[model samples]
Target: MNWLKSGFELSFRIRPVGIALAALYAITCWATWRLSVDQFFLPAGIRVAALLLCPPRLWPYLILGEYAYFAQMRYPMIEAYGLGWVILASACLMPAVALIIHLHRKAMEATTEGWLLSVAASAALVASALKLGLSHLLWPAPPSMPFYSNAALFVLGDYIAILTVAPLALLWMRRRSGYDWSVWRLPPTLAALCSLCVLGALIALVGAHDPMARALLQLLLVLPVIALTCMHGWRGAAVGVPLMNLMLSVTMPTTGLPSSFDQTTFFTQQIIAITSTALLALGSRITHHYHQQARPAMEVSQAIAFSRSAHLANERDLRERALGLRRIADDIEAALGETAHLLRANGHEGPATDLLRTFSSRSQQFRELTSRVYPTELEHAGLYVALQAGGLREAWDSSHRLVRPLLAGDPCQLSMGLQLAAYRLLAEAVLLLLEEEKGQILIRARCGRSGGQLGIVFTVALLDRHSTLTPATQGLAIERLSARANAYSGAVQCRTNRIRIMMRDTPLDSAWLAPPRDVSYSSETSARH
Candidate 1:
């Protein structure tokens, strides 16, 4: 097993070897999929999965293998359906589906759950529309069904196929290093097995001959999906959808099931697709919400630990983490945005219309939280703008305290590290002082040559002498300020009615003389270019 793994790993690295391996693998999968079950075109899923999982360079090999596999069937198809029909079949099922999904990979990578499933479903629709459109228009597509019936099944089949395969392929890539096998937990496992057992029993009792029983069984398939999704989020649907599909394919008698000439199957397949997509999206959101509620400190520690020896962090890393936090806000905000849908679902039309107006801004409060996690605004707007603008100012305004000459110095001159540390210090200090319900705090800063070193000194003071804040709370604030200041080897001081935090870092170089408006320009500019 190890030797085979090593050989496969090595082959994937070399250009020609990788191409050959991908092609051969594609052909083998295509053959096996064709022989597996005739209920659905599993190759459609494989074709879409290739685009979802592999890079552009590896795409041609997979497409070529699929084309070669279809080429064998093409000649026999021509003998039965004539050369023109055969040509149309080959053309419709070309590498174009790969291209369609290739473009959608970006939308799939988007942070929103709706974006992930909606875009992918749309891609499947587009592909199926392409294939079904031409084939239905030109020839009588099989099963002795109407054109509309064939088209519905065609669309639903692709949706079912793509959902079954693409998400699992993505999940495989997303698992952490050496963490692939750990994803299957006991709860989801038991839920999946129980679902399979129930489905098997349903199939045995109904006996496939009864159309109503068939429809009933198909409808009940969503129960397992709901259970699994409640248990494990998107990962649950990834397992359960495919598992249920396989169970239904193997257990149900495929040939004699006749309801509206098999339109019942199409209707049920659409339900399954919709159910899986909804489950994946909602499950992912719920999972993220719990994760955010649970691991805020872990996230902060991870941010600090990810820091490097350089003056500033790798901007990509910072941006990624920042966007990650922003996405938390997005998910939280999405709940509001979808309130209209919920209201509509519950049949509350009048208020649903009104609720859409403020739905966009409902999560404005979380902006402060996201900003605190990683100050992405610092990349574009400087330190002072970020502080003075958002929820950060509430610390002063709400408590009925006035900070005189609230901020000073050229915040842009401070190194990125100093600026962020200073911001956190100021934020923490303001938060601590706000406990008293009223206290004045002043932040004063200077950036330039301090002896032989180039750095900045920032001071935060509690101007109100007659405040009720405890010394322990004050001490904790100082400790946090000190932690932020540690990167600059700066100072933290606590007086009777005040606290002072000073920080300075990186050499005072020519660049510090007239610092640009944007502190982290090197990374931001390069990234834009």
Candidate 2:
């Protein structure tokens, strides 16, 4: 009869892989029932994996296949009509499992660890309960085991099957779909060593008759599984767990069934389930930690790249503006020369003389404005020479004490943008002090290394005790200087009667800069005094 049953199953394969999987599941169900040390079932994991991996449309075929297999397996144990009842009950159970999986599809599909196990366990328990209930109501006589004991066995077997086998099935399906598996590969030598250690431990435990020795051996099994999980993440857990189960099955003796429930086997199965869950959770956590660590570094690198790009764009724009201004200045100078020559030739000597003088004055102003826009002198001679020659001290009269030199730096080492920013900051600060009529202003400029980057600082101090320049009165100067300084990733600070501008020697690239706000006085102002 068993031979016929086996032959029938072997002949039941369909061409489609889904059908093939179902046939394989049915064969496993029969094999485990007959060959397992206890009455453990192993079909729940295959059923859940099939439902998850295959589309919903193909589920009915899988259910039908499972039902056919279940009915065939029960044929020898029950009457022909009773077989109908058994098949009907199985038919109902298969769909119930499918329906539960459908309801919790999101949880089943999550990449995290606990979701699959939790859903599978819940479905197993509920399906087992429903089957036991139907049996009690429909069967003519009570089964050999009491109702609760039978139900417990059913739930344990189903849940264990799902926990042990479902992850492997999921991984196999993922591989078929061309998912990347490189992250899960461990060094071949290390994996073989760990496997051997676990196998040896299990073999030793098999010979031990004491329950405590077996328990200790079971605990020892967790170490290699943990090592594998650490090495390869959840994929490691998936592989290591099933290997341990296979080893346990082979090493442990399969003698006569326990007169009562096999408490030792049940305890070992429970321990295995707990170990699998822990390993999976650990792997998931390690993956999450690596992701978290990588994110901030990536963000900073992108920011630096973006800043450099923006600086290049701004430099290009400024170069175009300088060319346009130079052309306009040349045209105005030529026109003025022609107009003066025409007047002189027409014998209007007095008017031509005045006109020439006026043209010269306006030409000088134009040259200054052009320099402010893009300083050719600063570009060529460096920041110090440009400031000394740029008329900053001349802007202030004898009414205010003139600070001799207001700029410092190795102009060749500095970028064009940095040079321009420093020149503008000093120019703006001197203009502010002149406009405010601040007497005896002391201007100091210094350049040095700061925080691994070259930096420049300009300090403008009002020496007159009567000078009363508050933040409110100096708002316009502060705003203009701050905006210009920020364009080069620099800062301007205005304290009582004094202002300081500081900047990194590196040229700014990012467009983002804080707008000018009310300046708070610092102790540095008093220290400078």
Candidate 3:
């Protein structure tokens, strides 16, 4: 018994289509009974309601339900328009409506201007016309039905039904399937506008007012629909469309709704809302693209302004540094002058004069030291000489066991900032090695010119019992060295205990060889002399 139960459950789970068909047939029976027999609630009279509540694949089942109900209630007593006629009529009209919707779907995918509007208008008109023709041929007309006497009014009513209902139905189904309800949450302003529009439409409907006012109100609904499209996009418009239709139904006359006239009006309002929603959503999207493109230009302008300010600040700092160096040079010259005078007056000629001379000599040395230490020469000398003078020699000797020149050739020209950073890195590595207890390190540097670029490698070896180093202390020195490599649009990498930094050099004009000197000499030097 348990095995049979398990098999039954598995069979039901596997036959999803069967389960759907069964459910649809059951609903159709209920709908037909309600419509032709009881005249209480019927899918035929409220086709939009049926569509919204039921699935598209189940539409034919509802039609079948209509046939069964007609046979049971009205067929024998009133007429003998067989089930075949009803089926034939539904087949001709239903396919046209479905095809129109399908074409509209294709149009929406086109991503061009006016495509959505074309889709909405064309689909709605075709659907309405098809339903009007079918209803005129198949169903009996009554005095209560709107435009029952005129073929044009019937088409218009049908057109309105398809246009108003279809798009909204499509949108609602999509949203429900995705389980998103954000469309329903309207902003206060939009909600207020929608409310006012509803009120105006209500007044127009109630007062049996001027035909022009009613027509104008009908057109005005399009404005709010477009506004909704702009504010909330297609999905929002879809939700709003159905809501507007429901509002229209409440205001308009209703005879408990399975009446042919009531169903036609309901369908028309639904179609209008949906079609306008699509039109507005598309317009909103186009407007959004225009705004998106403009945003980047504004950001770029702000960025340019920020960069300009930074450049000015840097120039200012360089000027201040130049001034400070001049002041320091002047002070040293004055101190040397007083010492020279004191030595000459005391008559301690040989020793005191030597001391005075040394003092004066050091002042001159200070001037020269200052110039070389902060020279623009490295930009010309490039990375090679910069490293030598900047104290990397000791590290190179210990790490690579490099007793002789580690890098030698025609100048390895590189960017000024890169040259400075590389020089600093090598110097730091040597210092770190020297601090070690057993402190013997091997360093090596190699330069290669390849593919219009220069590559340099520097490595250091340290002897420690524990080979592993902490992350904070380990390779941090090399990591800093690597950043220098990056400034030249190159890379820095390290493996095991070896750190390698490589950069490519750019071809330069002869003018770069002789960078012009911009140094200003101290005028105060003459006074000290």
Candidate 4:
């Protein structure tokens, strides 16, 4: 059975003849129903679905089948209604179907939801109006029924058929065309089963004995339709609502229905249409709200992750630079020592001694510059040593600057990137204060877990009101500090004479900082005094 079904589906996809044949079969089967004053019509569903699903080329086949079916059904009415009226009624519905197909093509994409109700409603209104107007103009009414009543019944029946059946047919065709069915979960299925069970039990218990109970049961049937709409969106309501309508049509007594069959069918169809529309609209609103909320959070998370990646890359580059500098310095010292010894052996003690002193001085200066550019102390000891290097502590001891460390965590636990960023930010801040000729600069730093992120906050503020710092100078300082902070997924803020910087403290693995072995800096060639 499964193999046969698979083969049939495969043939339907690969063979155009198979599709045309299927359309003819469906149209012929559905269009056989007798047209009456009050009963719900079925061919409208088949017609609308076929128009929507079939290609434009295949429409000829659908129309041909429809015309043949209508000819057979209208043979008895031909004497009273005329052949032209039957042809007009059969052809009038095509315009409404075309309008709906236009709308569906314009907006029916996978992500779009809740449009089913509007399309169905529009199709129903257009089809009902056209069918009703043409019926009145072309067909003679029975003596027992008024023109208005018959027109109303015609419109209501068409509207009911289109609303209840067309949507389900469209959904089935969509599924057959390869729409994923996994989105239809357990909730709608449970709601549908519960609705069917409740409806069956109610019909059996009432059995036309209690008019009030039957009416209440009809109303209660909408519960599952509402649930289905809310849970599985419009597709659920499309299928569930139509199934409930069919159940009610089969179980409920025709005489016990509202004042007349037309009134009851109209009222029932209207209730389902309105209920489904409201539930679907509400579901769409809620889905949109959640998407709106999640989009920003996702963007922020991505931005942070990107910043962290760039920060790690920068850290690796800095580490390689530091390693290259150290290697160059060692090579230069070795070459200078060898040159001095060879010069002395050639009986040039005076110049050789002078060259040795000069070499020592230049080597020390090179080390100082390398330390300032990439703090070796910070890498080995921590931020405290790096901040205190190069007379920073002496300036504080002289009361020329005020440096205070409020660190809370073990600096060794932090990533090398974080430590480097913190050291650079502090150094820049202190330099800015000195450049502004401030009497004193207060430095405060603390590191610990805050809000699930292990991080540190370092702040620098001027103690004197007479500092020479301008707004532009402060802005530049803040900008420089922020650049460094952001390298470690951190932020910087400045106000007046004060600047604060925060950074994430998660320790990065050393393997990520491995230097490229193919690149080498020769100390003797690259080093300069």
Q: Considering every candidate listed, which one attains the maximal lDDT?
A: 2
Measured by TM-score, how close is model 2 to the native structure?
Answer: 0.52
Ranking by TM-score: 4, 2, 1, 3
Of models 1 and 3, which has the larger lDDT? 1
Worst 10 residues of 3 by lDDT: 520-529
Model 1, position 61: C-alpha lDDT score: 69
Could you tell me every candidate's TM-score relative to the true structure? 0.50, 0.52, 0.38, 0.56
How would you encode candidate 3's per-residue C-alpha lDDT over 115-207 as one tens digit per residue? 434444454455445544544455454223344333343334433343345555455445544434554565753674666467556645642
What ranges in model 4 sit over 4 Å off?
Answer: 1-95, 103-118, 130-269, 279-404, 410-424, 437-442, 447-455, 462-498, 503-529
Top candidate (TM-score): 4
Runs in model 1 deviating more than 4 A are: 1-39, 112-116, 136-145, 177-184, 187-192, 201-217, 256-263, 288-295, 301-529
Worst 10 residues of 4 by lDDT: 520-529
If ranked by lDDT, best first, what sequence of candidates would result?
Answer: 2, 4, 1, 3
lDDT of 4 by residue, 416-468 (tens): 76777677678778777667645677787887787876778877877764554
Clashing pairs in 2: none
For candidate 2, give the lDDT of residue 176.
65
Q: Which stretches of candidate 2 lie over 4 Å from their true place?
A: 1-40, 108-111, 172-197, 200-215, 230-233, 255-263, 285-529
| Stretch of 10 with least lDDT, candidate 1 | 515-524
RMSD of each: 28.3, 17.6, 26.8, 18.8
